[model samples]
Target: MDILAKERKLLELEKQVEALGNNEAVNKLKSEIEKYKHNEMTKLTAWDRVLLARHQKRPTALDFINYMSPDFIELHGDRLYSDDKSIVGGIGSINGVPFTIVAQQKGKDLENNLERNFAMPHPEGYRKALRLMEQAEKFKRPIITIIDTPGAYPGIGAEERGQGHAIAQNLLKMSEFSVPIISVVIGEGGSGGALALGVANKVLMLENAIYSILSPEGYASILWKDASLAPKAAEVMKLTAYDLEEFEIIDGIIKEPLGGAHYDKRETFKRTKQAIITEYNKLRRLSGTELQYRRTSKIRKFGFFQRFNYDNLGGIKR
Candidate 1:
């Protein structure tokens, strides 16, 4: 029921736009949406955007997987703890090229939410993902990961089971894997939860998807002692896909629909599929060793462009 209000207004907008048929009224709505969205979102704090990333109505990893992948056969269980419903893994074909798809799925509706634990995966969930990753590597299938989670599960039980270690292991495993792996952030990508699956050859983020170390609220709470300053924090943090791309932190940006992914998932999927298809072909040509080096260089380049002052030396030093 949380996203119900947004859904209702969205339907109204849809009907209104359809009847207006690209007329002034439809254009007005578009303008209004852009302004309102920018105004509200720009002011959001890190944690506020985190909430938006986890919005129930926002399209999930499963939605994109179903739209883009062919013959999805989901694999389950961590072989350590009971299967964490948050992460969905399996063998599938991306753009008809055989690939192993792994995605973080946020549940909608009561039953599914309970099943998915609100898209927060436990230690076993990550372990299961690693298992699938190794299996995919064995078959030489390029891995595709769909990221969407507000970080890993923070529950006491999850920590007790070595959650941080599992996430760290995933990052290390992904970095050294010979097979090509591509990750796209379709929705909320917070902290290590996103990074665990994000160490890849190409990292793509949807226009609206955010990738940040901490939510605006969390950052504000810790640094400023007030969560109300989240919007300011969001502005300073550069969590937007555009911002990340500008900094060369992510490889590409997958554009969304006119309004947002929450407004029209079909349009979002269309563009996302194109991005994946493009990357898949491009990376497939490279040798496994070459791919790893490229990936390594890409990640290492982040924040590498820092001050190289050589004023005292009187020459531009390398």
Candidate 2:
């Protein structure tokens, strides 16, 4: 069985051990669980991490807010249109330091997933986020964004409402925002939907999270004409936290609990809280112009290239 299965079995065994009042069995199971958790972390492939990021039991943005922030007050609507529930934003305090929190919300079950549009946000969702961000900037509060989405909703209604324009506007505004912004990719960070909230001073990822321009399935379908080749596409895309961190695409990775974040919700929360606080403290030292320059410089450094000599130009005369 896989590590997740083993972990679940251990959890079940522990519960049964409590009922049986067997100390020896409980100690044995605890040791096995610890060993399994440690070993599983080293064995996970990029695709395995991707699956773990999307695990149904994984902690959500709201969960993080509850654990990391002492108090939170959710703000709603784009003001130009209706509220989009898929993206949630609010003002909250962590250790008495206030921040504007913005993040995507995936459903806990099928009914709620449909309600959240499977975390595929609409035009209004982006707009709502930008609005909150703007408010944060006005108050000089730092911005914290949590990304966990498949992509923007590709529905006809969303398109009609100008989805592309909304995302583009956010990219532009966030880049120019004068306050510090910290973004965390908590799960499936796909396409422009993810980028909308991801342009920040410090971009962090959960160790198991995946972030890419598109889903591996979409990439495989487009490039290889085979949706089943998604595993291959995932390997090639460099979407894992370790790969992205190596390339300096993300500022840092918040290490997940052994067996992935889903295996230890409170531990995940603690790690996330600590990572955010550490980064935010660093950013709080920079001036507004410094923050803007750092953000722009960081974004501009994404893709690597080499200068080619004129002699090496193939189609031109020497």
Best by TM-score: 2
- Estimate the lDDT of model 1: 0.83
Instruction: Please provide, for model 1 over 83-193, each residue's C-alpha lDDT reduced to its tens digit, 9 standing for 90 to 100.
Output: 888999998886568888888888878899888987788999999999999998898989999998888989999999999999999988888888988999988888998
Encode model 2's per-residue lDDT on 37-137: one tens digit a residue: 56756688777777888899898889999999868999999999899999999999998899999999999999988888889999999999999999999
Q: Whose lDDT is greatest here? A: 2
In model 1, what lDDT does residue 136 have?
85
TM-score of each: 0.84, 0.90
- C-alpha lDDT of residue 149 in model 1: 85
Give the distance in Å from residue 251's predicted Cα in candidate 1 to where it truly belongs.
0.7
